[model samples]
Target: MLVLGIESSCDETGVAVVEATGPGVPVLRAHALHSQVDMHQAYGGVVPELASRDHIRRVLPLAQDVLARSGCALPDIDVVAYTRGPGLAGALLVGAGVACALGAALGKPVLGVHHLEGHLLSPFLSRDPPEFPFVALLVSGGHTQLMQVDGVGRYALLGETIDDAAGEAFDKSAKLLGLGYPGGPALSRLAEQGDPEAFKLPRPLLHSGDLDFSFAGLKTAVLTQAKKLGDGLEARKADLAAATEAAIVDVLVRKSLAALDASGLQRIVVAGGVGANRRLRAQLDAACGRRGVRVHYPELALCTDNGAMIAMAAAMRLQAGVQEAQPLYAFDVKPRWPLQELAAA
Candidate 1:
């Protein structure tokens, strides 16, 4: 079946076509994406209203590009899948509106996919993928969670952040150091030349013995250090970046290992934007390798929000016999939705 997936849950608008032959076999025909990173760069963060308007402008053209590139017309699509919730309401509505309209016009079925579910399944799109019954660490700007995945649509939330997400902390700390928006990548780049031992940053709740994480205090620590630096801040930026990165990586790796031991799962799937952190990946890879476990990640391009994951997720849901909503079905976005509440179709 040919599935058209639309993702506009956040700053990027993505559209893709995926073909699912059966349970474990899926092919990506084509995908297109439009990122609003530069658009919001001036603001130092995403402005919800601007993001929604941009999605309205780009979603259609992107869809057209994907369809044309894939040699598939609107009518050729069997299912229209869209990210339904867990994002900015206006952003979600843009994708939902376009998808539902297209589905209705083409007489195709439409399925509302959970945003994080798409992230969780993204690793499978790779040639080398992990099987079911794995641990998933979903670390993004808005969320940080540890989950146990037994199958598609089956997830058990083990723990999550009690405060700001790791990615948010990274961005916030970067901002304090005079780095601009989307600080994860920018700060990490600076950390390469930084001396990790130059500054000692606290690893909050590292030995909490629970899966839950807390980076709020760590971010505050960076603020305090920045204030103390006074006029010498410029010279110490890299050192601060390195210390922040090390502190975060340490907590994440330790918590991930603890989760693996608790779940007794040998395979770990790291998803969401923060999964693209090179340091985190390196640390997790080493830890997992030492314990005879494995780690999986989406391609770097797919690490953030993209339509390919949504398309692949929709294909999997269709293969699992998930049902589509009615043609007249219209629902608002969910700014806060629990993953465990998602039901199999």
Candidate 2:
């Protein structure tokens, strides 16, 4: 079965084609992505309306490119899958409208996939795909969560952020230091030059037990430190960035290990944009390695929101018989849908 996926949840417009065979991991024939980062960079962040317009302009061409590269035709696509929410409503509608329109035109069933589920299942597309019954850490711009994933549709939320997510902490902290838009990467890059112990940033909820996370206080601390640095802030920005990265990474690594110990699951899969953080990956690798626990991550390219993950997710859902694509062209999106709600789907 050939599953065509479309992703326009936020700042990226992605399209991909995946072919599923029997009961194995689906093969990604081809995938393409167009990042709106440069466009949104001038505005400091994503403008939902602009994101939606760009998706309209880019999705189709990306779809065509994926089809051409994959050596597949529109008629050969067995199902059309799209990221259906927990994102900007306008952006979500663009992909949904296009996907549903395509499905209607091609006489194929369409599936509305939860955006986070795509992130969670993305590792399956990697060269070393993980097996079932592992813990998953999903850290992204809008969310940070830990889940016990037993299978394609069996996800149990173990913990999550109560306030600002880890990605938000990175971006917001970087913004405080005058970093440009899409600040997380900027922050991480600068962090490489400074001492992780420079500014003594806070590591929120590092010891409250349970598995919940909180980073809002950490962002506030960064703001306070930035103000205290005054003119020196410019010179010490790298140090501050390193400090902030350290604090966040410390909490995440600790909490992840705690989650592993509590669940008795030796393997953990990290996904979403923050999962692309080199510092996080290094720290997790070292920590999990010392404990003899295995860790997995989506390929860096797939770590961000992308069509490949969505197609892979849809294919897995179908293979597991947990859900089926529908012929209904009428569709709606859930901008605030929680991953837990997906367990009921």
Candidate 3:
């Protein structure tokens, strides 16, 4: 089956093609992505209206680029899949609308994929794929969660953030440090020059004896520390960035290990934008290595929201016989879909 996937869930517009034979992981043919980072940078955040309009302009061209790169025509695509929820409503609608239109025009079935599910299943597209029955750490956007994933569509939430997510902590902390938009990566880059132990930062819920996470306190601590730094802030920005990253990564790594222990699962998969952090991966590698537990992560390019993950996820769901593409054209998007709901999907 040839699946053409579209993703306009956030600031990036992406399109891709994947081929699924029968059972097993699918093969990604080609993909194209356009980042609205420059557009959103001026605003220090995403503007839904601009993001939606940009998606409208970029999706078709990106789709065409994917088709051309994949050496396949639109008619060769058996299913049109799109991110249907858990994003900006207008941005989600753009992808869903385009996918439904393409499906209707091509007389093919359309599949609505969960954005986070796409992230969860993305590692299957990597060279070294993880097997079933593993712990998954999801740290994307406004969400931070740990789930026991038995297989495709078989996910049980083990724990999650009670307040601000890890990504939020990164962005918010970076913003406080005078970093611009897309602060997570920017802050991470700056942290390399500073000492992770230069400043003491709180690690929330690290010893709570449960799998749940809380970064709100940590973010507040960063704010308080930055304010206390006064005119010395610029000289100590790198140190602060490093300390912040350390605190966030420490909580995430500890909680992930705890999740693995709680679920009695040795294999762990880390997915989402934060998974791209070198420090996080390095620490996870060291921690999981000591326990002889396996860890899987998506390729750096696939860490963010993209159409390839959506296509791969849809193909996997089809291969697992958990979902079927529908011929129906009418479609709706969920801007606040929960990952746990995939158990019922």
Query: Which one wins by TM-score: 1 or 2?
Result: 2
TM-score of each: 0.97, 0.99, 0.99
Output the TM-score of candidate 1: 0.97
lDDT of candidates 1 onward, in order? 0.89, 0.94, 0.94
Provide the lowest-lDDT 10-residue window in model 3. Answer: 336-345
Candidate 1 clashes between residue pairs 3 or more apart in a chain or in different chains: none
Quote the lDDT for 177 in model 3: 95
Q: For candidate 3, lDDT tens digit of each residue in 109-155?
A: 99999999999999988999999999999999899999999989998
- Angstrom error at residue 156, model 3: 0.3
Q: In model 1, how large is the Cα lDDT of residue 54?
A: 100
lDDT of 1 by residue, 1-345 (tens): 999999999999999999988666578899999999999999999999999999999999999999999998888898899999789999999999999889888877788888989998998877778788999999866788999999878789998999988998899999999999878889999999899889888998898878999999999999999999999999999999999999998988899899999999999999999999999999999989999998999888888899999999888876776655455646566767778788876
For model 3, the stretches where C-alpha displacement exceeds 4 angstroms are 343-345
lDDT of 3: 0.94
- Steric clash count of candidate 3: 0
Q: Which pairs in model 3 have colliding backbones?
A: none
